[model samples]
Target: MSLQGEPAHVLIVCTGNVCRSPFIERVLAALLPTDAGVVVSSAGTGALVGRPMEPLAAAQTERYAGSPAGFAARQLVPGIVDSADLVLTATRRHRGEVASLHPRALSYAFTLGDFADLVSGVTPEDVAAFGESGAEGARPRIRALVRAVAARRGLNPPLEASQVDIVDPFRGDETRFEAMAQQVMGVLPTVARALVP
Candidate 1:
């Protein structure tokens, strides 16, 4: 899909737009080619608009890659949902919240992990081909293998289901924030490839 006149827009969602989502947005922007013609932004389904990222998250993010200078948090609104070509949320609950607010987004909305799956075209048959016994057992095996490869290459593994949710790390310590950030960052390049390629 050529992001020509229409820039591919991605909106990352979380609880307060102060932690996971913002970190994902910055990492995506940095990982993607500057001329890739994709516009990346983030919001919180229930955010404290005009606020900065949580102090701990900000500190951790900065420690790894310098401060997210001038970054300001924003609340998720219908307009943001409507404008996004892709909507990635932190969890299944967050996906539901966004969908309830913008039912029109149901098709485009997915957990970041799930979107990764869509891009890779990993179907049930593919899972079965692994011959890992039952479907349930096979799916995780496939996902883990893919995730391992992605991690090695700094890419996002394809998601197995849109329902596969990322755990939120709100009100947690810097360690938690770092863990969440690492997960989000891992998947961002995959998202970027999907949007730009």
Candidate 2:
């Protein structure tokens, strides 16, 4: 419960760690707070373990940000899933896979885009109010917003269940990957704020 001192460990999941997951890992690592003591890592359910990221993904990552340098594909291990304080996946199916592996780990796995949905509900008014109140009140406000969005969309909240699935980009061309990356990047700020702040 106390993520203090001990780094807030996050594990990102994808079908192959060589692509989207690594991309996300790098992006989050670059953007998320370093002083918050959070560590971001990535893995794949069926990854090649020691393989390097896909060439296109690696190239795009360099162009986007230089954080994922020398990243090699890693297979999703039970211990990793169990140990992480947060687990994010690239697809709904990947969330399910993680859940099945560690049912107790359900609270952590969430789609990158779904977190955006939660953030969308936080209006400028809410942000201003939160700034005045402080971080404790801000957290409850964020949780409330997540619930409101989930109810309106009739989607189960990922915080309560391992259901939010991000769009998959496997085998897709550069264009599709770019689109997916955009979607993921859009939510990074929100996630960083929530997890680190």
Candidate 3:
């Protein structure tokens, strides 16, 4: 159920689609402004394909997702990435997979952690220019912010693995999943504000 005639689509990708990607998806869905007309979803490079998120991950999503009914795992494909306005991949390698599917996606796709790091410095002034038209104005503003981040992609030296990625915690115990969710959530607050600010 899309709101806008042409909504901004955010596609998050990971390996198993059970933990990180689904968690991020629900967070974004809950965090983004309702009027902003942004649609967030997740898929996996090697997804479970029609499965639910991990129990621990699903438990965490309730704190942010408003309900437990929204998370579902699916396989990733070029067509899904192709339709996205922004593609936030779980790993650099996943980003590579997205790029391999669509060369132009490079401009729109980013590793989630790297994307968070790249845009961490954005201020209220950066978002203020979008004005107050609600959803009508949020789309261009989001695109502007994305471009602002994309422009800085190569300026920084390459990120070591830790800074650029969140470790996969698919089959791990509750402790590992908690740590991964914390990292993902840490990046969420600032970036989520930028998306709907």
Candidate 4:
């Protein structure tokens, strides 16, 4: 998440980038502090690069805080995985893609809901005990949060299906897309509030 005290960077990945990843990325960006300098970006394991978000997902984001005017799908790259502090994949398959590409990333990377489940168990005291490296900006606090969650690797209980993967809604099914959006919207704000100071 950091090198030389830089802001934490998050990379979200899905199958096509045109749907779930873009929607989730924008929502997280909107939830975090702009000044905190948290970098949130999305990509696809097999992305439709240069394509805008799928219509159904775009509509969902519009209902929230994102604008479809500036989104473009992109394929995942090793560099993106290397730079990310937290790599949240839309599915276990996507997470496997990231790990197979970079074994060292296995610790920091997770499925979106998997990450939520892990972080949900981290109490405020755990964050405090991770050490305060001067309480000014969010980078330290965020790093602490990530560290805390990472520490819970084997300690926390396993996750249920609904908390480990977001169903892809790119099949031209608006109803499925809405359900996916609800899942993401419900989880991301809690994550942002925990990591953002």
Candidate 5:
């Protein structure tokens, strides 16, 4: 069900941008094929602007087959949210921040783990059907998928905060960074598959 034109931009957000979001961004980049028409990027709600990814987080990125090369932290802005077709934030709090910046984004923005859970039950056929019903091109298909996920909200049990929020590992130890990687990677592969499979 992968579409090939009109790339869909996916923005990942977190507090510092040097840890969770960047790592998730790189790992997702690695998981998705280059021509999948899905572009993954990251930003921070309160960024350490222009800083490279935290050393430990970069290590985790490499461990997961994702390169940490040349990543620069950037602050989240209204324009960034407005440009994105999908937004996956590190926490529910980050999701709230995105909605504040672009009220319309509430339709497509989601916590990374929460999005993983919601999209898990959506099959490739479902995505194809969604794509068929939307306007032409990959971006429309992505928008269709987002609409489908949003429609399913509240049909399932609520996810606890701990289940969806990836903890910040900017100043934490190796173990903390490892936990962040574990939390993100656990759900992200499912998300990638849903986006491109």
Candidate 6:
């Protein structure tokens, strides 16, 4: 089921798109419910256009049950922001960039780590209850869920400065990629539950 007459769209952003964003995109895609028809994609602020995921990051994605096949980086554009129902960026800086690209998107755009943390306290029932009056199905429920999470932004601050950004591991070793993957995977289940529950 879909809201807005189409599948719910989630966009992930990073600097180069070859490491952080692509890996997160694939993992998040795999995590989302297949029947929900959620569309997950990624782009870069300064993309290495046409490049594939960084080898180490791709390996981590595979380790975590995500496929990194045939991926190519694309530069972030305004339309991408406009189409996204939810935008999860690698860092706070990327969140700001998305806001600058589309001011209206600010309400639904968040740093990936920040989103995970904020949504941690939001249970599946809260999301379903939000759209209970009229909106039904996973798509509307997800839309309501994103809005619900966004509403909690000012109420709960991140525990630490580091809890708000996924560190770029593009130029790092396998260890760095592993750490990055851990950070991302740590929060995805919370997001998936809200979106697909």
Estimate the TM-score of every prediction. Answer: 0.72, 0.73, 0.86, 0.89, 0.94, 0.91
Report lDDT (CA) for all predictions: 0.68, 0.68, 0.79, 0.83, 0.90, 0.85
Candidate that beats the other on TM-score, 1 or 3, i.e. the better one: 3
lDDT of 5 by residue, 69-146 (tens): 999999999999999999999999999999999999999999998889999877666666666554666688788888
Q: List model 6 lDDT by residue over 43-152, tens digit each.
A: 99999999999999899989999999999999999999998889999999999999998999999998888888899888766676666476655557667888888878
Which one is best on lDDT? 5
Alpha-carbon lDDT of model 5: 0.90
Off by over 4 Å in 5: 1-3, 132-134
Clashing pairs in 6: none
Rank by lDDT, highest first. Answer: 5, 6, 4, 3, 2, 1
Model 3, range 1-197, lDDT digits (tens) per residue?
23454567889999889888998888878887777778888899899988888888888778666344856788988899888878898899999988987888999899888888888765556545533445344455666677777766777676787876887887888888888878888888776766764
Name the runs in model 2 displaced over 4 angstroms. Answer: 1-4, 119-167
**Model 1 per-residue lDDT tens digits across residues 43-101:** 99888889887787777666556357678889898999998767888887888999999
Q: In angstroms, how far off is 57's CA in candidate 4?
A: 0.9
Which ranges of candidate 3 are over 4 A from the true structure? 1-5, 122-136
Better of 3 and 5 by lDDT: 5
Candidates 2 and 4 compared: the better one by TM-score is: 4
Q: Candidate 6: lDDT of 137?
A: 56
- Give residue 164's error in model 3 in angstroms: 2.6
| True lDDT of residue 131, candidate 5 | 69
**How close to the true structure is residue 47 of candidate 2, measured as C-alpha lDDT?**
93
